[model samples]
Structure formats: structure tokens, C-alpha cells
Target: MTITENAPAGAATGADGVEHVDVLVIGAGVSGIDAGHHLRERFPDKTFAILEKMPGRGGTWWTHRFPGARSDSDLFTYGYAHKPWRGPSIATSEEITNYLDEVIEEDDLKAAIRYRHEVTAASWSSSDHRWTLDVLRGDTGETVRMTCDFLWMCQGYYNHQDPYRPEWPGMEDFRGVIVHPQTWPEDLDWEGKRVVVIGSGATAATVVPAMAEKAAHVTMLQRTPTFVAAVPKTHELAVQLRALDIPEDWTHEILRRAYIEQFNELTRMCLETPEEARQFLLGEMRPYLPEGYDVEKDFNPGYRPWQQRIAVVPDGDIFTAIKEGRASVVTDTIDTFTETGIRTSSGQELEADIVVSATGFNLSALGDIPFTVDDEPVDVSQAVTWRGIMISGIPNMAYVFGYFRHSWTLRADLVSDLVCRLLAHMEAKGATTVTPTLRPEDADMEIRPWSDPENFNSGYVMRSQHKMFKQGDRAPWTHMHEYAEERHTLPAADLDDGSLQYR
Candidate 1:
């Protein structure tokens, strides 16, 4: 089988216009950019294009520009394997966007990006061995059609257009400003205002400290406490490596590996020793709080450490704000919204002039793009995911999903590498398509949740679990959240493991 460009003669134009490519990458996020880079480097002969819904590059970083918006994960792990992060460990939205722009310029991927092309629907044709995508062009309301041999869903799993906001009783009665962090008003004045931030997650953790700096007093109102840790703003290992006359790329690689291994160990500890891990984490929080403060009531979460994402604060900013009396935390249920503030279930009335709902995201899968396989609408909830990349019966398609336990890009790099390898395998076989074909014996196997029912109880995961594909009880069918397990198993995974069928 020799690799060469092949366009089917049956390919025809749709009502608006039609374009064909070897690979169609959806969204211009970090995952999409990595897919583009991998395709260019590994399969130069194959034609591909990236479709981004936003007006420009940087999907999450571009859209989320709220006050104190930064990554919960460190930069070394979040940054791509090909690109070394030169900024601080935890990067702000602007810094991240700038890094993405630099990556686009450095790799010269701007030409292949079709900005404002939002994919609304995708249909797979088994007979044609291609995917037809209906894309909505932002400039014009017209829907354009794009056909590709392989469909890569690089859009990160979450609905960026809408965030989750619970309806509160008497919320309308409040006379002050109410803002959700997702769509923060750019010109809104926050200075010297009594601010109340709802929720106790990453968004709330960042917003409380950030608003505390400018506002008269900021109060974080939470139903439950979330585990928060302090990570250094700068990479100490990178600095030490650089001081040792190590090359920039080498230094980055060393620090990246170190962080990955460390996180992997941490995840293991959380799973194997929940009691000890919980106690240790709470102990870490003790020093950051003021004297006589209640650690168990204020810092301890209902769940174990790694059950949900651990929010990282740079230099203990949030703790520092609380210690200095600039910010405060209230752990109680909201009874109702008063005219000037919120009333708690404990009969506590907190006065606030501004309300910031730092509530979590409305999780989404495949960007709500309606999918059809051979004219039959595909239901993702009914299907099983294969290796966290491809759905069991989805032919010639892959999506990027990151690890819940560690850095997102760690799994992303592995997925991209596997995809490039699989593409090469298909080219070697002279095949146009490959799908994860389930065996007859495997069909009767008991289906399990995408994650362990007991271990995976994150609020977002629980809310969106029904929309996501399931996982089987065995290998290749189960998605591994552990980086150490994936690092060893994924590279060595056999394409001919009786699961993948090629044509």
C-alpha cells in the first residue's frame, strides 16, 4: 500500500459550498492545534483543515477573560510536548492566549485555520468511508459543507456558549449587579463594592482572591468546601535546571517528567490511602490559615482529595486574603437572595453589592454537534469509548480527552501520537477507514461507567456523565485516568488487538 492523495469521484458539492480534505480537525483549541501539528509532521501528504468557532485562535483562553482567570494546572504539564512553556507555572488567560498565538506563528498553522466555522452537524457514510460536516459560518448565516476521510473532534468537552447557573429564589429582587464569571461584563466596576461569589470550585477560588484585591470585601459563599493547594508561581525545577547550563528544551522536558511522575504518585496515594491523604492535605492547609480558624469546617471537602479537581492557588493568595480579613468564606446553603444580599439556610444574612456566580460549566460532549452514522443518529451515551480517543463503532474518527488526575496535555500528547501511528498503519494497509470493532464475547461483558462509580464523583462529571460515552470493564475499552498506566500501555497498545477493524 503506497500513500497518495485520493479524492472519491462521488464527492459532490452541497447547497452552500463543499470542500474535501483527508482530515477535518474541529475547534482551534490546544488539542486542535496539537492535532494539526501532528498531522503536518507525521503525514505531510495528507490534506487537513482546522475549523474554529471563535473569531480567532485560543479556544478556552480566548473566551475566558474574567478577573484572575488562570489555569488550575501547571504550565509545564499543560503546555504541548513540542512547545516548552517559558512563562510562570500557572498562566493567566492573556498569557495563555499569547502563548497560543506564538505557537500558531511559530508553526505557521494560521493558513489552515478556518476561523468562525462552527460545526453544527456531522454524518458518517460507511459506503463512502467519509464524514460530511455541516458548518455554520459566522460571517454569513449560510451553512457550508465539508467532507473529510477522517473526522477529528478536537473541541474540548464543555459548552463554552453557556455556563451552569442555578435559579435562586428572589434573585430578581436583588438590586445589585449579578455577574457570572463565564460572561463577565468588561466595563463593570468592582472597586470598593461588597462582593459575594457563589460556589467553592476553581472559579470561585480564583475570583475571591482577585476580587479581594480591588473590592471593599469579598465573601465566598459555598454549599461545600473544595480542596485547594498552593503551587509556586514559578517552576523551581526549571529554574534550577536552567542554572545548571541545561538547554531550554531539555530543561522543560526534565521538569515536565518530574511533574508528571509526581502527580501520578499523588493520584496513587489518593486512591490507596484516602484517610491519610485527606489528613495530609488538611495539614497542608493549616499553616495557611489564621489562628483559631476552623480547618475541618472551612477547608475539608466531603470527598477525598482526588475525587474532584484540586484547585491550585498561586502563592496562597486566597488564604492570604482570608488571613488579612480582605476575603471570607461562608459554607452554607442559600435560602434565598435578598434585596441587597443572600440569606443562608443557617439564618445568616450576608450583605453584598455585587454577586459573582462562579458556578461551574455546563458540560458538553462533541460540542453538541448532532452526529449520524449511516443515516442513523448516533447516541454517544449508548456507545463505549475505546482508549479515551475513539468511540467503539465510530469509524475513522478520534477525539481528545485529557486525564482527570493529571495534566490534560499529557494524555493529549499520547492520544495525538497514537492517532499518527494509527494513520500510518492505515496507510500501510491501503485502507480508507478503521473502526473499533467489538468482539462477540466482549459484547456480553458487563458495561461499566466511564469511571469508577465510587471514585469519580466530581460535580461536573456527575452532571454530564449521561451525555458521555461509557467504558467497559477491560483494557482498550476502559479509559485510564492514571498517567503512569497510560504512559506504559498506550504506546505499546496493539492496533490488531482483535478490537480494531480496517478496510
Candidate 2:
């Protein structure tokens, strides 16, 4: 199974020239770093390189620079399974990036990564049994060619260049500066200014309280309420473990399991008893707000708990800001942008010097890279996901799409193991490629959305559903399972199953 250093013996080369490897992993974020570690550990004889479009590592963490940008999920599970997170459960972007830096350094993955290589187009040739990639170097204006036997897509699920911002009437008439959290300006100042944050998602929840500290006043304007819960920055048990002089790795493993069990129970409760779960969430939120605040008006969501995602505020910081009169919440649709502020449908004028649009982002399928199989373009929407890792009709390629309800890295780590196992299986079978194909018996299986709207319908997912791959109603083709289910199913999944065609 040993592969040559730069050029595999059987791989093809382009006319100009091309570099070839056994595996080419896309992105240098959490998932890519994990993939690097697995490849080095399990298959030292194989040659692979990681490609990243940005100038540095940390895909999402590096891209998001807005005020108060942090992880909404607890770091215990969000952190890589092999690494120990010693910081607070909810960490800032800088802290997360530093953690990634340590992982890259400790695992000797820095030399295997190319910082400015961006894959623009990929074409697969069945005869050659290889993939030729067209990569544009961000550092230079030139495009380079490369080839690989296997492609691992870990570029993330969202479009980092553009964010979703709704068009409101009279936007041109407004004189205030409008900013989107995705592209937060470096020189913009909000101190001593009237600030208004639009939308009630995680971004808005993080920005409002952070800006309220210095802004003359801040208003969180939302069309509808979102379920919000307050969580401690540091887990109580983690502190106790440190007090006992327990080893860091021991503490990490114990807390990781504890958090996973706790979240699994919460998710199950939300699914089985919607009313009770909703009541419990609301009850938890009530103690954080002012004694007589109208929780029903500003905090109660139209949907049940975990319908989309519950925004987590560290130490009830957002509520504390509201209780101190530094910030306020107004739930109403925008009528139009006034000369200096925004006007609500209720005829109330909310004046502001600056506005932050914390609307969601756009989903990118396979990093929006154009693909061709033997000169035929690939429309990803028409295909079905195979075990939520490989797509039907796509050969020698597997992608990392994480869970929406849980920490993304949970699924990322699981998929890494599955991909490594599949690679080993292929090598043992002496196969050049493997593709997911629908059997004749599966012809009549119902095709459903990638994620069922009933289970979790976030705005970004619903807005981009038509562009995502489809899922079948049968085994090995469906992926709407929870982390607890996937943790077991993915590892024990039969690689010899008929759904995967080996050549």
C-alpha cells in the first residue's frame, strides 16, 4: 500500500505538469487537522497534502472577526476527540485558533499544509482512476494543477465570501452604517453610539451584549423570538476535577462523556415531549431575566425547543445587560429604514447610529467547486448521500458534513474514522476506486430532503435545501440520525454492503 512521494506510479499528469498524491484533503480547519492525524497514524506509507484557501489555518474561526465571536457549543465536545480542551466551555475565536495551532504543531501537520491553494475545479477520469484538480493560489494570480487518488472534502458547509442579508425597503435612505457580522469592518467604532442589532440568532445574541458595554444603548430587533438558554462558561465538574489534581487527559475524557450524555438526554426530551421541553427551556430562561420582565413576549419562541437551535449565553450575560437597562429587545417586523434608524411595523421608531445584521449565512456544497466526471458536470442536488459521507455516483471521494443539533466536530471525528476505515478496506481489496450506487431494489425508495424540515429547520438549511443532496428512506442511504445513534452505527457500518460499488 506504499505510495510514491510526489507522483504515484499509475496516476496521470496534465499537459503542463501536475503533482500527484495518494490523498488530497481540502481545508485546514478542525476536520482537516483530524484527518491529517488519522492518516499519519494509520497509513504512514501513504502521501497526502492539505489545501487551504485562506492565508492561515482555522477556517471558521479565522473568517469570523466580529465582536464577541465565540463558540455556541460547549468546547468539551466541540474540541477534537484526541485533544484536551483546558479553556472555558464557551471559548473565543482566538482561544480556539490557539488550540488548533497547538494541534497542528504537536502532530507535525504544519509541513503537510499549503496555505493559499484553493481548488477551483476538479475532474475525475474513470479510465485513469484519478482526479485532476485546478487550484488557484491566493498568494499569486496563477493556477496550479494537481492529481490525487482520493479526495477528502472538509472545506466546511457554508459560503465564507457572502452572507445572507435580507433586503428591506428604504435601505438606501438610511444614513447609519449597516454592518454584517460575517464581514465586520476593522475600523468601525460603536462606542458611545446608538447600536441596533437585527435578527435573534446566535450572532445577534453574542453581539448585542458585547456592544452594550460601550455603546450608548443597544437594541436587539427581531421579527420573532428565539429560544435562548444561559449556560456556565466553565463546567462545575471540570473545576472539581482540577481541584483534585487529576490528569488533564483523564478530566477531558470524563467531561466529554458527561456532556455527551447530558446533551443526548436533552435532545431526546425535546423530540419525545415537545411541550415539556419547551416549558423547561422557558423556565430556565425566566430566572435570568428581570423579576417582572415579559418573558412570553421577547423570549418565547414559536417553535419547540431544539426546533432550530437554542442560543447559549455565557453566565446569563445577555440577560444581565437587559436587566441593567443597557440594552432592550423589540420584536417586530421592519417597516423601512428611516433617515437615521429603523421604523417598525407598529409605527415605533428605533434610532441608531449603527446597525448590525446578524442574519445567517449561505450553504456551500463541496466548497462550491465545479466538478466533472468524464466531462459531464456534476449537479450535487440530484444525487443521494451514502452513509452521509460519500455521495452516489461520486467515486473515491468522501465529505465531512457534521450534525446540526450537536457539536459539529462530533460528526467530523466520526467521519474521519469511517473514511480511514474505508481507505484501509479498499487497499486490502486491491481496489482503485469505490462509489455509492443505488441497487435496483432501492429504485422506489422515497427521496427526502437532506435534513427533514420537521426535525430541524434552520433558516440557512431551508434556504439552501434545493441545492443540497437528497437522502433515501432506507438504511445506508439515510443520515437523519442523532449523534448517539451515529456514534455506534457509523463505526459498525458494513463496508461490504451492496450500496458501495468497488472497482
Candidate 3:
């Protein structure tokens, strides 16, 4: 993608007061910002800076302004590991963004942020025992280089590509207004327009009902159906959390443990027997659907539950919208866009005044850092993971890995803790660097799709590091498909047989 106006520019040329830092963090999105805070707390007086590509903070939140944009995960689980979200179960985009802004404000992270600067490339320097980075500030269009002893990749997955628009035959020539939920335009006029939301994942599920509030007609178009689960956005526990008067970091830890346990049990039930899992999920969700609704077409998934992150909404409001006839569903693959509307593979064409391509995000790792191990683009697919935290060949780096089959913030918190723990160990040992390597046997397992293969391009599944590992000893110890497994696998203390080499 060519550079656009949204990109930030470097401030000034001279590094007069720039000096050097113990770490150079990239991107101020959730992962980057959260990691930067942890780094600061763990090692104060060690100067570090967060280099963001945008004019402001909020990585995916800032970039994706789609209609009805909100978090799929409950706010209780979606936020930072160190700072808990105080209100509601699921939060709106605006609310979440506000939460992040507050985190930045309270921490006094503004001074450490170098906004508008995107790291174009970074390489490990053997001689200097640090990493050299080349940055381009979109605002100024100036190139600046930076160096840091340790480079951390916290830029989350959603940064890579624009929302995908399949070249469904004649989509390019469709006469309707086509938009992606990821990059929604605020000025867009969807009022009273006939709208069709494409894809069956969370994005499609989210946009249809939200737009139905104003659009004259709303129709959801799905390639394959996904399992739907509904829970309330407000609960007693949330009220208790807000009233606790506990410190933010302590609150973060308590809620973090609670969610880790909740999601882990569900994962275990699913992996114990796929049938029992499906039955349990169906039992919990089937009653909410309209009378006589077919679970097979509407919710029965061919892939295992949690195989694709299940879509969650508040109290099945989407179904309520459909039941009230404000919205409807169409299960068919899109063939092409016609002059009037979309022609699906089922020989049906749905007319629409505006079409939303909620097709999902692409898998681009390391934010925008295009790496070359030896003058060749490093193929992340071909690389092996060292317990899903660090890649085998990369040195002086630790990739941020989110949760699957569990809460995302749960694993991220663990990764942040481990990074701090490791750094403290290095500090005690008087070491300059530490890199974890995967053992020969540990790297031999066959890789499986972390999410559904059909969802290979969707951001939630694709944009993340995709590899699974066994953890600890005995039956429950193996992390086949539960949050407990991850809880066991990722510990603040040394747990794994890691190859911790120092330079």
C-alpha cells in the first residue's frame, strides 16, 4: 500500500537531545503502549520511546472507524493486562478509545510517544549489541534512523492491510457505495439506504444491526455461518469492579485471572469431546434464536467452536433486530456485484444502495516491518515458534502473541510479565541481551490453522502468530484447547526449558 495522508511525519532532524534508550518500542496501539508502560515500571531511568505511525494513538481503534465499530470481546477482557476496564461487559469503540486515552494520560506517556514516526525497517547489530531502525515520519516525509539495545514488537496484527474486498466478479463496477467496516468514513450517509453486510464473522454481525437502526433495509450476506453467543454488557461483577477502589494495576490482575479461568474451562469442554462441546454451546445459545430456526445453517459450525473465535453480542440484539424485521440474513457466497446489486453463487441477487465489505483483515506480522534475514524476505510461515512467544531465528526480539481459545488480554499480560521477568533476570546477571531459541524437537510439530482456514485472511485469526504447543505435565497440564493450558504455559517465573543465551 502506498503512503497516504493518514501517515505521521517526523518532527525535526537533529537528535541533539535524542540520545539513546535501553529499548525502542514501536507503535502506540494497545500492545505497544501496554508494553511500554510495563517496560517503564520494570526499568525506570532506562529511557525508551514508543514510535507510532499515526498522528494519534489507538492502533486498530484509531484506524478502523467503521459503522457500529466496537470490541467483540467483553470490555472486561478486551483491555490492558495492567489496567482493567471499569464499566460494562462489552464496550463501544468510543468508550474503549477513551479508556486507552486515560491510560496514556495517567501514565504521563505523552512525552515518551514519538507520534507520526513509523519504523520502516530494523536489523540486529552484532557489533553494537543493539538494533538499528530506519523510520519514516509520514507527516514530515522525513526519514530518521534510531537504535536501541532491545527491540520489542507490540504492534498488533490489525495494522497490516486495508479491509479486504474480494474481486467478486463485477464488484469493481458495482454501482452502490462499497465500504469496509475497518476503515469506515464518519461522513458516510447510510440513512435510509438499502444496506448489505458481507461475511458472517464478527464484523458482519456487528455492522448489520447497527446500520439497520437508520438504513431503510438491511441484509446480512454470509459465506459460511458462524456460531453466535450472547452475554450482557453489564453485570454485578462489573459494578463490584468499579466500586472496589483498588489500584488500576491490581484490578487488572484480578480481572485478568478471572477471565483466564472462565475462557479456559470452555476450551477444555470443547477439546474433551467435540460433540460435548458443540452440545454445550448449542444448549446455551439455541433458545435465543427465533422459533424453529435451524441451528445447522444459523449456528452449527463445521469447524470446532473456538477454532474460530465465536462472535459475541449483547443479549442477541442482532437476532432481535432480525426478528423485528429491521434486518435479515442471506447465506450464500457472493459471485459478483451487478449493476443493481450483488449476485450470489446461489443464483440470487440482493439489491443494495450501500455494501459493506466486512471481509476481514490480512495476516501481516511485525506491524509494517518487512524483514530480510539474508537479503530475502523472512517467511514467518516457515519459521518455528519457541513456545509461541519468540520465533526461532530472530535474536534480541520477542513477538507479541495474543490469546486464542481464551481471552486475548490474558496471554498478552503473560507475555508482558515474562518480558519483564526476563529483563529483570538479565539486569541481575549484568547481561546486555537475551534471546530464547526453540529446541530441535520443540520445533518439529506440524503447524495447524489457529482459526478456520476459510477465515485465513480475517484479522482476528490471520494477523496473529499461528502455532500451538503442549504445556507442563499430565492430563490437564497439556494445553490442547483451553485458557487453563495457556495459564499453565505462560508464567511470570521460569517454566519452560528455554535456551536463554546472553550476549
Candidate 4:
């Protein structure tokens, strides 16, 4: 690792030819964009640059090219707090990327972003109060170094390059094409082919109906059922607000708040009266299914409502495909992969020409980047998160990990606000470094998993729990709270509460 002298603020290069900035943001995704916007708007004198691993902006949207790729959360809450989302509630990846493009162009953020630059390792020097990042340029194999006073990690929580694909029995013997949604092949044709999608999550819910459009038949094979709700493609209130000629910003805020309230109410209902919430969720899908279709066998989940994420089917399109006989659902465990297709444990063989593993993604801890503090390697999983943003023992670094029950961007925006506030506070104190430290009172606090499995047990979270940071039983140490609570608590969080050590 190359160490250089810390350059003054706003200086692009230091004496040793190392590029330096006030802040270095990792990833140009949703969180990164929001961070960039807030830093520019709140602190115009600060120099920062967004380093994106992909060749362009729209991190996940640009990376995921699977059919029917869209957001499970409504765009109103999923979009940036500053930008107005004028599109429908459920939007495709294209629409999302387009909206992100508008934000990039309108804010003149193109110049501040360096695309195709991936950060391999980040080393922080306490002596100099700066972070040195070893970045690799994708277009060229050459490696470059950049230093920053503060590191804003917005690379998201999942591995974009390597998705979680389980090795099934006889996968090598399968003659049909097997594809994972994260890395969809551009030239692989699925039209007029029998397709079988494994897993019943949002990706499967989206892909099944989409492939059914031209595929001979699409089968959604799942080991267990998931709570699926049919939401309107366009929100009713959004239509009314637009009809009244309300300004875009006003509509965005109104819809954003409305969705937050609705989500909170549903969450409360699920927690307080789980049986009623379960029945209600199941009842909502009954009308969308074909007559005589066994909803309990396929749509009814084993767990209570909100235990995991509920997949939202826009306008009941997946159900419509099932009703039209273009697609079908099979709830069973896979025995093995035959030369033709998958053979379920029930001894039934379903032949297919293509198989899509819409299972899930591997959770990436801090973009899977190696880190070092004062030349000593740091293991992130051993550290605890401070307000779900900064990690314990790491100085001048903050990450954006969003809420699972609500839209990810909602917390992203909140974190941006908190980070900006923290930066301003640091400036006011004339402190060059700030770290979330364990207080004397916190030493005895119970250390828990990053998220309580009982509260939210999504497959991705459960499978990767060992790789995530831990949370404590106290305030500012816990991070898995709902957005309804954090929306206020985060803004009002005391920075000088002795939880953070500054110098």
C-alpha cells in the first residue's frame, strides 16, 4: 500500500502524485448518488468523487438485466428524497435507470463520478488521518491509488458480480441452459422455450410472468411458499394528485409519506396481529388467481406475515399468467437435476429447456473490500455498527445499509443526512477523525447479530448473518429498527453522546 502526505482540502493531487479528496464515495448506486447530492448541496467547499465499479451509473439497475427486472418497493420511497419520481409505483429497471440518469444530468454529477474504477483494498492511516484506496480500472488492468479524508461506502450490501448460486445434485448432468438472474446472458434466447425458475422470491415472481410472455411454458418451482401481494401498478393517490396538477416535488413527498405510513401500518399489523395480517395477505391474492386454483398449496407461506419480505406482483400479472395457463407454480423440493429438467422429491419430473436460479444474492460486507486500520488488518464482521452507518473501531468511514421492511433508499437518504451532519459537526469541532467507539457502559451491553432473525429472516440475511457486523442492545448501537422510528430518531440522534470518539 502506498502512503502519501495528506493534501489540503480541494487539492486533487498531493506531493507524491496521489489523488486526494475530502471524501471518497464507493459505488454510484442509489446510496452513492444520494450521498453525492447531499455532500454537494450541504457542503459546496468539500471535494469528493464517486467511484463506481460498473462502466456506468445505475449500479444495480445497470447490472441486473434479467427479464421483468423491477423494484419490489414503490419508487416514491425507493427514489432519492430530493428527486421526484413521476413514474408509476412499480417501475422496471429501465425506468429506474432513466430516473437516475435524470438526477445525474440535472445535478451535473457526471464530472464527479469515475466509472469502471473498482476499489480492491482500503487502508486508513490514523497518524495522517486519511484513507488510501487501491483502485483497479476495469477498462485497463492498471491499478491506481486515491486518498480521502472520509470514506462513504455506498457500494450496497450484496455482491453484484457473484450471486448466491447453490450447487444442486446432478447440475453438471443437466443438458438445458441454467442461468442466474444476476448475470443474465444477452444472447440466450428464451422465447418458445420451456422455462423453469427456481425460488419464490421477488426475482422469481418477476421472472416467471415475464418469461411466460413468449416462453412455451414457465414453471415456478419452490420448496416453500412466500407471501405474495398484488399491488396496483400505478398508485391511486398518485393519479389523483397528478390529475389535480400538483407539482412533481409535492406529489413525490406526499406519495412518499403516504407509502411510509401504509408500510408502517402493515408492519404493525403483522407484528401485533399476525394471523389477521396473514389472512389479509392471502385473501388479497385469492381474487387474482384462477378459479379452483389451490392458493394455500402455493401462495400461503409457512411463516407469519412480515417474517420475510412479501413479494409484490404488479397488477397481478403473475397471477394473470397462471390464470391464462402460460405459467404454473410447483411447490416442492428439488431431488436432482435430470438431463432434461428438474426432478422433484415427489418423483415428478418437469422437463424444461431453460432453468433460472432466481434464488438470491450473496451479501457483500463493505463491498467485500479488505480494510486495514493503522496497518493492522481489520475484520469487519467482528465490529459493531454505530447507528447502522459507521463501524466500531473504524475511523472516518460510514456505510449505508438500508431497511428490509421498507424501501432501501429511505434509510439511504436518512444516512446521507446524518453523515452530512456528522461531517459538519466534525468541522465545527476541528476534528480530523471520528470513530464509533464502545463506551464504558456499552462494554457490558449484550452483543447481538446484525439483525434479529425473529424480526426479519430473509434468506439472504440468514445465510450471510455470520459475515455481517453485530448490533448491541442499546440505542445508537441497534440498526434494524423500522423506518417509521428511524425517520425521526436518526435526525435527532446525539452525535456528542460519548458513543463517538473524535480528535
User: Tens digits of per-residue lDDT for model 2 on 383-450?
Assistant: 99998999999999999988888999999999999999999999999999999999988999999898
Q: List the residue pairs that clash in candidate 3.
A: 8-138, 8-139, 9-137, 9-138, 9-139, 9-140, 75-89, 89-233, 264-483, 361-459
Residue runs of model 3 more than 4 Å from their true location after superposition: 1-19, 239-258, 372-379, 438-482, 492-498
lDDT, model 3, position 24: 76
- What is candidate 3's TM-score against the reference? 0.86
- Compose the digit string of candidate 4's lDDT tens values, residues 1-503: 23333332364775677898899999999989888899889998988889999998888898989999999999999998889999999999999999998988887688888888999999999999999999998889899999999999999987988899999999999999999999999998999999999999999999999999999999999999999989999999999999999999999999999999999999999999999998899889999988888999999988889999999989999999999999999999999999999999999899999999999999999999999999999988899999999999999999998988899999999999999999999999999999999999887999999878789888988988898899999988988899989989999999999999999
> Model 4 segments beyond 4 Å from truth?
1-11
Q: Model 2 segments beyond 4 Å from truth?
A: 1-16
User: How many backbone collisions does model 2 have?
Assistant: 0
Candidate 3: tens digits of C-alpha lDDT, residues 1-503: 22222222222222342235567777787777788778767777666778888888888778867777777776666787557677677788788889989988877787778888888887775566777678897878988777677777878766445545577788768888988876776789989899998888888888888899999989999878787777776755556755877765666567656665676677666656768888777877767667777767767777877667788877787887887888888888888888888988989979999998888876556775766543456555555455556654566677675764455665667777877777777778788866655445544455444333432233444445352222322221222233465555567335334555676
Clashing pairs in 4: none
Better of 1 and 2 by lDDT: 2
TM-score, candidate 4, is 0.97
Question: How much is 36 displaced in model 3, in angstroms?
Answer: 1.7
What lDDT score goes with residue 171 in model 1? 98
Better by TM-score, candidate 3 or 2: 2
Q: Which 10-residue window in model 3 sums to the lowest lDDT?
A: 3-12
